[model samples]
Target: MNKILSILAVGMVGACSAVSAADIIGTVTYKGAAPAEKTITPILDDPTCGASYNGKAPTTHFYAVGANGEFGDVIVSLKDTTGSTGASAAPAVMDQKACLYTPTILTVQTGQKLIVKNSDPVLHNVHLNPTVAENEKANEASINAAQMPNGADLNYSFVKPEKFLKFQCDVHPWMFAWVTIVDSPYYSQTGADGKFVIKNVPPGKYTIVANHRKAGEKTQDIEVKDASVTINFTFEPK
Candidate 1:
């Protein structure tokens, strides 16, 4: 009986060790001069939409670089990983306020719910245009739905991974957003401060990727053991 108990204790310890995980923390920055953002003149010309901006037009968010060059809206993730609990994960949200998408860029795992809300007082439509060929089901998930003023939220999800799936407003041509669907839970989008963290990654080697819609992508190979790892990336203006 004692020998059996010892064997069971060893098995328990092995099971505990197998669940060990670490985190990946990183920062994304931009190098060189960022291109000038042009103002969307049509937004100011519109009657209802223009009123939300208080007579000032909004410029494009193509380069969301901070004062110190910290890059925002960049998707940092583990490449080629496939274990996603997105179906049960909390739904991601995108809001339309003042004739613009609150977050011009977003990241969600495959099968995760994306809730789109229109906070504007005018009429708007949520148009999803996915162009990936690898996942036919995801490509067929394209939808164009009209959302009335402060109307009901539109919900969507993808069955496979896709990059930069575009969401545009047909009513307001300048309003747009990009959603990158990752197949793994090990992904994060950099905030305005350009920082991100991917948590609970098991001890192993991984290919970390940082992708920007306009600046392109950067990748690095990394190994994680018991402790967390830090990796940084810099993207130059295109």
Candidate 2:
């Protein structure tokens, strides 16, 4: 009789433990509105512009996912999800191709090396410029490294957290890309559907930072304790 009681007690504890092990997850969608399209002023505006805002005109955002302007990249929610297996994350890849970064959205851990790959037929000098706006040589680091060609990777690391680094090919000035280096492992780049997830987080409270670049960032307070929780975000372009 005592043996039977002990067995049942163990079974109940095992069931409770199993239930507590599930991770939190959910999708982030725009709340009431979508981001507004961002525009820029040209140096010398043509009379064709027919607008009055200084030399500023709506920029011709080339890529379907304009990495240069508002609604540019996805804002990943970091703290909204939590569990045990989230710490000690691995570094992600950020490649340069056709004169631009392959993934418009990039997530990286502090001290993580950024692997800059080049696949241009011509020689390209990878220069890292620090800034929030575009300018000529904004404290750029002209790598003395070999002029990469074909498909070679150049490994670089930032000593400090920069605002945002602009990568350019000195040989091909038109080929420009950007990457935002953050200090945590929870960063994520949202997809076209505007959804993201961070799994296996330990029980705790966190501030989920949603960076949309031109539209800025949206932060939310989240607490992860018992089971998985749900959280979302949205930004209207300004």
Candidate 3:
């Protein structure tokens, strides 16, 4: 009788663990001809920021395509459903340097703290204007006034999920960035190598989405059960 009870206890434990979340790993690639890079000459230049660029116009890294057609700065997220992971405790960081926003694009979980830092020696005001529906009200979000050059860091949290939030500098017209706020913690931005991973997703069926500033959006249906799943996406000219 003792041996039978021990076996039942172990079986229950295994079943419980099997229903837990797992990781989804994938790479984003682009075939065919890559998009040409564009350079922007700072129109509203302050002597402080202009000095860093050394008089040469800065180019946009919007479409960072690699030799193997790897695409970078793409946002990847799992479709919101009944079952999803919780928000992460760690905060996401965005820095402004050399008269441009570093990382260019970023993704964070809704209600998670986002730290925006200005590493430059000039003043910059970070403004967030979210794209929302006509009927819905927008989140009037802005940083603590103009971030005085070499001033303290700015922090904020968005209660609602906004796919793409526009980040711009009130002082500098050319300075801009994009931020994606997701309800679930299963979201990531493709790195320079165009690779991303969403961990701790519950075992179930989900629609995985990939969005790029220029290439637009793509979706794929996937079923995650027990073990890790590998999926790849290709974004090309329409």
Q: Against the true structure, whose lDDT is highest?
A: 1
Cα lDDT of model 3 by residue, 143-199, tens digit:
425798777888777666677688888888887888887777778788878899988
Q: Which candidate is the best by TM-score?
A: 1
Ranked by TM-score, the better of candidates 1 and 2 is: 1
lDDT of each: 0.88, 0.54, 0.79
Q: What is the Cα-based TM-score of model 3?
A: 0.84
Q: What is the TM-score of each candidate against the true structure?
A: 0.89, 0.63, 0.84
The true-versus-predicted C-alpha distance at residue 198 of model 3, in Å, is: 1.0
Which runs in model 3 stand beyond 4 Å of their true positions? 1-17, 43-45, 82-88, 133-144
Residue-by-residue lDDT tens digits, candidate 2, 67-168: 322233554646433221223445456665434456645655445666776655446677766553322232234343446556567765544444346666
Off by over 4 Å in 2: 1-24, 30-72, 77-91, 131-146
Model 3: lDDT equals 0.79
lDDT of 1 by residue, 195-227 (tens): 999998998999999999888889999998766
- Clashing pairs in model 1? none
